[model samples]
Target: MSTYSNDVFLVGTLYGQSAVSVSQILSGAGANVSSTALLGAVLNEYNARLNDPAVQNAADWYSSYRLPTHQEIIENYNEVAALSPTEQLAIGKLGKLTSYPVMIDLGPGNVQLFTAIGLLNDYKARYPNSDPLNLKSYENDYSALAADLTDTFSDTTVKFAGLMVQKGTEWGSNNVANWNDLSQAEKNAFAVFFYKVGENEMNARLESAGGNYVPDLAGAPIAQEFYSNIEGIDSAVVNSFGSWWSNALGSEQGFAEAQKLEYYADFFEQNPEAFSTNPMFLNHLISEVGHDGLRQLANVFDWPLCFAEGTLISLGDGTQIPIEDVRIGDVVTSYESTLPLGRLQNKRVTRLFKNEVAHLLDVHGLKVTPGHVTLCGDGQFAGKHVPIIDILLSDGALVRENGDLIRMAINKPVGSREDQFVQVSYAVDADAAREGNLQSGKMRVGTLLFDRDDQPVSVLDCIQAEGMTFNPKTGLVTRAGGSPEPLYFFGELPRPEDYILRRSRETLEGILTDGEWEGTPSQLVGQRLRQTYSLKLH
Candidate 1:
């Protein structure tokens, strides 16, 4: 008899009647009975109970009819196994609802019977036009299909069940012989799947399934052709490609090698010209070295430049010396005038307490070069002095020509080449002093001082007799009216008797006039007396 009839008989015996009763029923039905005829009695009893309104309770109805039991469900499942693989696949798909089943009023046993029958019927239906190799359903519900296959196969080969379920419907194989037999479209679809799943996960899945499918697929001509033209692949891109290769090969080492090949291919594709010029070096750079190495290589083609502060130089002769050894009064070669050969006669070493000199120079675009002389003017005399040009405002003193002060403003333009003719003083050496026995340690030629109007004042006229009031603050001198003509001394202190008489007379008169002096005469007399007193003290 057909497996179907055997399954039905087994089912009937388990639920419909005792084995002896089933035998009697079969005998009364007669030998060589059709499978349908053998099940007729049980089917009729089941139908009658299901149609009866008085049998409203599902459990009561099922119990009275003695419907198919768990054994019958197993038999039905076995019958499904007997179907062709294609048919089984169709049934699997049909039974594989996307969601859980809704509860119904049917008794549990009746429900089980109906479920078994439903499975059997689905298995019996004609296979659909779906392309199993495309694996659309399996891909959509991989977890469900895996579980279902494991449940149905009764073996540990469920790992490769996804491949078995594909078109051509093969079983018990872990090779790509079946994969090769698929249509081009199906092959392409598989490649897409492999690319999406990546190397590690795909390799793991294939290894679990006990398949050499990874290497076979990765080495395929289609895969090679697809990856041949990839470019601009950095580390991140390499990792992704590595993953894809790993998924295809199920081997990390194999993926790494393949990734290197792809990287070189991309490099070559992007720099065809570079390859022509220096293929060996380029290959070494791209393959054996990293970004920093490439940067070092690039630096070989660049040209070099730098600037630093220079040493102190002598103004008298161009001799370089350490800056720390420089002292005040040391003469330095002039930077102010190239025409007259001016020199820095005075050098002042100022200790800076605040601000950075280098920063200040940079800010003002000033440079400290040898023989640099900053010209300073005060009244009639202009001097060549070397003032420490720095940010510390209090460190350097202004230039002094004769006794007049020249003030240097902070915002003054530096490094200016404008020249001002001024007198320069040099230190007298002991040898020179002994040789000449000079009256003054130093000699002066240019105008030494000036009046308030900036007019040159005679150095000779500056020296006067005593009782002549000399205001150093205003650089002015006055004498009492009708006093003896003031004695003049060239570079010497004046005498007191020549200008002291008028002042003495005015003092005596003021004492007689209630100790008061009036008008211009009084004012003159008072100023003279004050001067006489000042001279006396001096």
Candidate 2:
């Protein structure tokens, strides 16, 4: 028989003949000790499992594994968790109704029995005194209860399962293998099944099963978007973003009310040409001007680009101090010629930075020689080169504009120069990378990062989040969320259709930057706020 059938049988027999060998072992001190209750627990669990639509549909395909004894479910978790990341992914996608069940520690009680108790508790919470096994059938011949939730697991469930599976693999010695062998459909199936485990059912599976799957403190079920009819914003996203923003507005001066109006007014007049090219600017302007302006801006862009909160350190020659530690009047290194690294071979600063001269001066500091550095003036890349007393960072290092010493990360060759102007290569934390459409490899300058409700967040704030990287010169942001993995940035201008969404995002960002904003109910801010005010420009 298949491994599934074999394992199921091993555990199933424990339920079918409650008083047999399975019972003996269960009652033995060496086993779970709740032997007598195994049969009844299994029956309840089996009935509960049947209530799941996926389980019901999957039953016929893998009937041999269905209705296994309570003991079998626990055992299967161990085997599934033991699969390679590749196989785990496969199993996660295509294992029929397989889901990572929740585990609960019930102190001194029989862990297995307590596990069943947890599942029953969950059923009670959802059905509220109603029996899961006795739900009324619906027109589709399925229960309305089943229709209430998506068959695919919620985001919380998915993240929780990932934590358990990854942790279990870490604690246990499991071989890593090429799980990619599974077809795409199979991988998708695993994700769907892995997440479908109910919060309570998960607790039961863990307690009863001898498997190891502990939940994290942060992994507790967050209401997220479970209740509200908000699009684009959920609790998870809101909580993280709101917490970050409320803390950020307190320190950021640019967010002050007066500064915001000037920032936008100057931004619009100076960037009128770019208004068509960069929709984010328009969106922010509209948000500041109110309704009609919001609509106008929405007409121009396609996605929201906001700054996230975080620190950005760029590697530069000693002339520039890292932006995080910049002090007034700090001398920075203007430029330094170093031996060619990989891409720098045979290329000078001129050829490397390319048409990027404008961005270079505006965003980075320069180092010319040892012990001497100076910051570039604002909009230096736009052909108005003015040195500032402040320090700057580029690439991945910390330095001072006074040409003082600090540490530095490796730097790549990527900048350009023309006539009297020179633009040098620099790195950007992913949080600060430009957000725009992508074409070849080049990206247009724009905002990036959004709040929980799909509203734009500040790039500065995003930098604080783990795993954000930005290449100031390259203008790229690399992000991996869910199974949808892609390096997104503002590579090119978006199509007309996307401009409205983009503009709305800009308006929300402007509003946040303008107010000394603090966290509010995310569902309300993201969902209700958007619906009521049409804050989304589009």
Which candidate number maximizes TM-score? 2
Query: lDDT per residue, candidate 2, 80-177, as tens digits?
Result: 44654445434332343445321221111112221233333443454564432332222122111121111111111111222222222222222112
State how far residue 55 of model 2 sits from its true place (Å).
23
Superposed model 2: Cα runs more than 4 Å off: 1-92, 97-243, 246-297, 302-538
Deviation of model 1 at 418, angstroms: 99
Q: Give the deviation of candidate 2 from the true structure as CA RMSD.
A: 28.8
Candidate 2's displacement at residue 366, Å, is 60
Please give, for residues 1-538, the per-residue lDDT of candidate 1 as tens digits.
0111222222232222222332243235331112212122222222333354244232322221221233432444456546654454344322422211111112211222222233223322412443312223433332222222212111111112122122111211234446656654345334333432323345466567677553354544433432331221111123322343344335655546444444434544543222211223333343433434343333332111011233344545556565445544556443344333233343333211111111112211223311122343432113433322211112222332232333232222222211111121222356644465333221111123435775434333343424454433333335766433222222322121111222122222233233111100111222334455676798
lDDT of 2: 0.28
TM-scores for every candidate against the unseen true structure:
0.13, 0.17
The TM-score, computed over Cα atoms with residue i paired to residue i, of candidate 1 is 0.13
